[model samples]
Target: MKPLNDVIAACPPSGIRRFFDIAAEMDDVISLGVGEPDFVTPWRIREAGIFALEHGYTTYTSNAGLPELRRLICEDLEKRYGARYAWDTECLITTGVSEGLDLALRVLLNPGDEVIVPEPCYVAYEPCVSFAGGTPVRVATRWEADFAIDPDAVEAAITPRTKAILIGSPANPTGAVQPRAALEGLVRLAERHDLYLISDEIYDRLTYDDTHVCLGAVPGARERTVVLGGFSKAQAMTGWRVGWICAPQAVAELCVRVHQYTMLCAPHVSQIAAVEALKEAEGDVREMVADYDRRRRVFVKGLREIGLECPEPGGAFYAFPSIRASGLDSETFAERLLHEESVAVVPGDVFGPSGEGHIRCSYATALPQLEEALVRIDRFLGSLR
Candidate 1:
């Protein structure tokens, strides 16, 4: 063939999808690999989408998003997170948090700019930074500290080329929530260094034990932070491809321009659904979070009983347990579990180098499947012994 962009060529296959594809080929496999809510989109939200379609609301919206949807997003942020964002100047609805991440990087990064990322995070950040022509500087979070961001380590990673710090609270893979103190410390560092803060709060509503603290809510941090959120996890609307970014007026204006060229506006019907989801699906979100909490406890307790060491996750739906004690690396452990026990999970190393000894098990599935998966895991562990 001719040639492809080196960045595209350098990207590896998605780690989360690899196991999911393998599981698809096997019969009766219980999958905990994908980090998606298993619940259906609430009927009210679905009805809104259907209503829009019935009313012939299929046309493209403004590049920034539907005005009403943008207004609802602003209102929701103010009501829920105590944050204020101008609908006209401070927000741009996107295809999903995935696009929001990309837009943030595209708008802010220049070639060779450095973006600080914490290790054992979601699989997207580093590659996204690379694609945006930024260098990703990873700082490791220790399991012994419950994976809290170490301020000193983050400070040490910053250089003159540093442009932004990427933070995902109620983080993926590890399910660690950054505490308010940690967030404040990071905000201070961003302020001191004059760098942007990309706060990925897609899992903000899935927290089990503590309230989610928005970085924008911190003093002086709002101006420098770009908050990314979506309806995928909390409202069971992953397939809808609805998300948004909230930034200060100046940055948001640039984001909207980039959004205009990349993918103009989120889908109109999906925006209608997302607005309804925020307005009426509060109960659904709570029920799903509560259910995930139950599954988290069940899975974590079972893993501990089987002699696997897993940290207590404060938020998000995943349980990242170390499988090293079982005498296998994470990749081998996950492969053996899928092939031998009919259970599927993501290997920890897929997240980053720091995750080598662990495996991420999502609790987004039903209770029965979770129970059965635990039983299979127990049997597999016993056989190892």
Candidate 2:
């Protein structure tokens, strides 16, 4: 057999999906494995898509995407974060944050370049760097420290070849929202080293009590940061596959260049729907955020009651709870729980080596489902004891 591309072949499958696949084949299962908003795309957003489809608005948008969507995205960014982006040259609508992230990496990385990635980040980060022909230099963020990326660790990881820093807050798996000071420290680090910043803000609107500090809005970060955002988590528009990149004019242009040569443009209907999402979905977003806050309280409290000591999640809909008390590594704990209690969770070690003693459980499900899953999780822990 012919050998496949080395970089592509070397990438491991997503660990978050292992338990999810298992649960899918089972008749009675509670899955907290997938990192998605359980909420359907808001009614109005879906209706916009439907209207577009009916009206034959299926043509390809500009390579940079629909100007209207880009404008709305910029407007929303300015209103929400005081981050001003010149709609035409500084914004791009991507297929989703996934594509946006890939574009950002491609535009920035050269073969053998190093991108410092904070540990326990989203699964695709390292692989994306590899695919972009860059080296991924991982810096661990401790659960003990609320999974915050320590600037000291990040600084120590930097090297002559280091070109960028990739970060996600209200982060996946851990749900750690980096505080403003912490983020500023990171920005300083980037400025000191002349490094680019790739800030994945896909879960931006999914945050609970904490305010999401837009990295691009930071004083020293705007020119160097690539802000990846989307409608998936907040607008519950995952299936619509609409996301965006906000960056400096030069970087934005290069990203669009790669995007045009590769993805061409984001789906026209999806862009239209995203426009509607930006215009009319604030109430829907506020409602969803409030609900997620309620779930976060109940779920984190429930996790603590069951003997799993979890650091309070500052944002996002996940609770990354320590499983060390069970004397089980993350994989073993998550596997046994699935078979023993029919509750599925992602083994945290897959997120990074620093995640070895924990498991990531999403609380994006309905409150009743979350409560029931907690009960099963409690029983599973009891059996482990």
lDDT of 1 by residue, 1-385 (tens): 9898998798998998999998999999999989888888989999999999999989999999988888998898888878899999999899999999999999999999999999899999999999999999999998889999998999999999999999899899899989889999998999899999999999999898757887788877899999999999989999999999999998899999998987988999999999898778899888888888999898899889888899999888999999888899989999999999999999999999889999999989998999999899999998999
Per-candidate local distance difference test: 0.92, 0.91
The residue pairs that clash in candidate 1, if any, are none
In the range 183-293, model 2's lDDT, one tens digit per residue, is 999999999999999999998887776578999998889999999999899888888898999999999999999998889999999999999998998999999999999
Every model's TM-score = 0.98, 0.98
* Stretches of model 2 off by over 4 angstroms after superposition: none
TM-score of model number 1: 0.98
In model 2, state the lDDT of residue 38. Answer: 88
lDDT of residue 279 for candidate 2: 90
Candidate 1 stretches greater than 4 Å from native: none
Task: Please report how far candidate 1 places residue 146 from its true position, in Å.
Answer: 0.7
- Model 1: lDDT of residue 47: 97
